[model samples]
Target: VKSGAGYLPVDPSYPADRVEFMLADAAPVAAISWSGRELVLPAGLPVVDIDAVDVSEFDGSVVSDADRVAPLRSSNVAYVIYTSGSTGRPKGVQVPHTTVAKLFANTESVYGFDESDVWTMFHSYAFDFSVWELWGPLLYGGTLVVVDYVTSRSPEQFLELLAAERVTVLNQTPSAFYQLAEADRLASESGRAAELSLRWVVFGGEALELRRLSDWYGRRGDFAPTLVNMYGITETTVHVSHRVLDAALVADASASVVGQAISGLQVFVLDTRLAPVPVGVAGEMYVSGVQLARGYLGQAGLTSTRFVANPFNAGEVLYRTGDVASWNSAGDLEYLGRADDQVKIRGFRIEIGEIESAVLADVSVAQTAV
Candidate 1:
């Protein structure tokens, strides 16, 4: 089971022996289990052995397909992301390298990133957003400042780091951004926010209203940090589109324009028949071209259902995003809602109707809409 450092699992079958070596070599940042007494932790990490701990403490894994390598192979295993399942089992999603690269390149092009800028990583390695904040900066030759989990969780501590680090870029959820914007220190001059050299603030992992965010930042004057709203799902690398923060645009549009498709990516609003819906008509958003995941691990049926052939073109697969959206004449997209009953609350999607149906049936809640 011996292996070199940096040996991470890239696929389901990673020579069990090699993976064992990795598991053995992995230094646990924190460990939690019902049987904490029997568990051993990696060096230099505190033990928070509870019944459960958030997935943030674990290292994120990205695996790639061996045969598919060109264009970075969206099939290439990008991450071994694990999360809680409805049946109380842990489910892992296979993200791909091509997808990650697509997102990184897209953001770089959209934001005009340069080596001089410094971006802070607030999300834990387990979260998909961390991929963008970590690798995006690295690939673009920008500085990446990793903030401690404790500091990230605290409003005061987080702002202090933002100010001290002179972070030019920040990517966080809407809730996280709201907390920072509403902080007493940032709201006042005595707070170091104004003095801090932050430039662009990116928001992802949730939908954000442009007007609300603009109004909040506008109070700080015209030079306030630019806010970028990005739309994406865990399965789709990190992001598919972005909307830059412009006060005039926000005021005029009444909503943030989720910008055009990223490079090497194609977005379409399709009706039930998988036909492209007319412009300005709401339909399921389907993602094609690069940046799409290969398929769900071992779930061929589910994978086949979601990852179907592209009727528009042969030899291509398009991901059924399940998000309802419409395109304006400018080619920008406006998100309407989820095609399914799933509800995105605070940026997380759940099926509430499914939960109620399950409750009435007195069986089990297979899923719930949030």
Candidate 2:
């Protein structure tokens, strides 16, 4: 922010108790909300009513380095996004300016983003994916379209918005994109077609069913809106690896290939002993680099356990992502699934994702959950 203040975005739909809990946990200096929005506020907390402010009266000019009250540092905590705490409470991940900067450090080389691009704020700010979607346009000098809650839930409306705004960059979860693809298919078949200007459709949040994309390719092709699968977590600042999906990779129905690490990020698939496993062997994924978050807000114990000192990189810490994965022969990391998602039944290990994949393989099954 201009004043170097760290913000925590909570879902407006949260219940009174949940909202109050987050407010107490985060302990923000002030609470901001629109006038029309009725929020559950804590007593004695400062409130900033956005709708009441007359922005037209302000200078609206860019401030130079000399005009600032204080110099903004890269180490400053840019935001604190609360994630679903495994323990039942929400834990905040304090993302520093440097981490966010590193996320887009190689935008030109990795993504080729520029001023001409237009990105949509598709995911909620409570989710770490918003960090990428929100800062993407700002860091890359591109346009940002803020999608409302109603339209964001409707795939048909979202697709129409993409066409209307000429959005060049789109980000989505595999589940969300599936719905959009279906909407696109229906529109095309119904002769109510609206050609989109999207150049990239990035995927994250969950494992993608690459085989299901065959229908999408049949209609729009893969090269038009180059599909990319970026795998990552909140503590790692949105994304770790970037892989542009193509027909070749998508042929393998069960393969969830998340390619090489981003420029300033590092990843390793290791065994229980913290030693790197052999290629093609499943292991827990660990990540380290500038993109790593400061840690959970006021959660020292959690900070130490997950963000432990890296055995390989002395003096550095690696965030122990509970994700299970392995390196392919070609140097790409294939996401197996969550470590906990794998269950042992009758002395045999079973990955729920594998079962889900097999069920989804059936043409009659539109969607399946395992």
TM-score, prediction 2: 0.88
The true-versus-predicted C-alpha distance at residue 266 of model 1, in Å, is: 0.8
Can you write out model 2's per-residue Cα lDDT over 217-238, one digit (the tens) per residue?
8888768889999888878888
Candidate 1 structure quality by residue, lDDT tens digits, 1-370: 0111111222223334333333443432333335435333345646554656577885556433332234343345655554323332223456766566677666666778889889998876656677788886788788999897689778777877888788998888888877777673454755444456777887877667666665565675445577777888766777888766666766667544677777787888888888888888889988887777766555567678878899988999988888888888777888877776666655555555544644655556564444
The stretch of ten residues in a row with the least summed lDDT in candidate 1 is 1-10
Q: What is candidate 2's local distance difference test score?
A: 0.84
Q: State each model's CA lDDT, in order.
A: 0.67, 0.84
Model 2 is weakest, by summed lDDT over 10 consecutive residues, at 342-351
Clashing pairs in 2: none
Alpha-carbon shift of residue 112 in model 1 (angstroms): 3.0
How many pairs collide in each candidate, listed in order? 17, 0
> What is the Cα-based lDDT of residue 61 in candidate 1?
62
Top-lDDT candidate index: 2
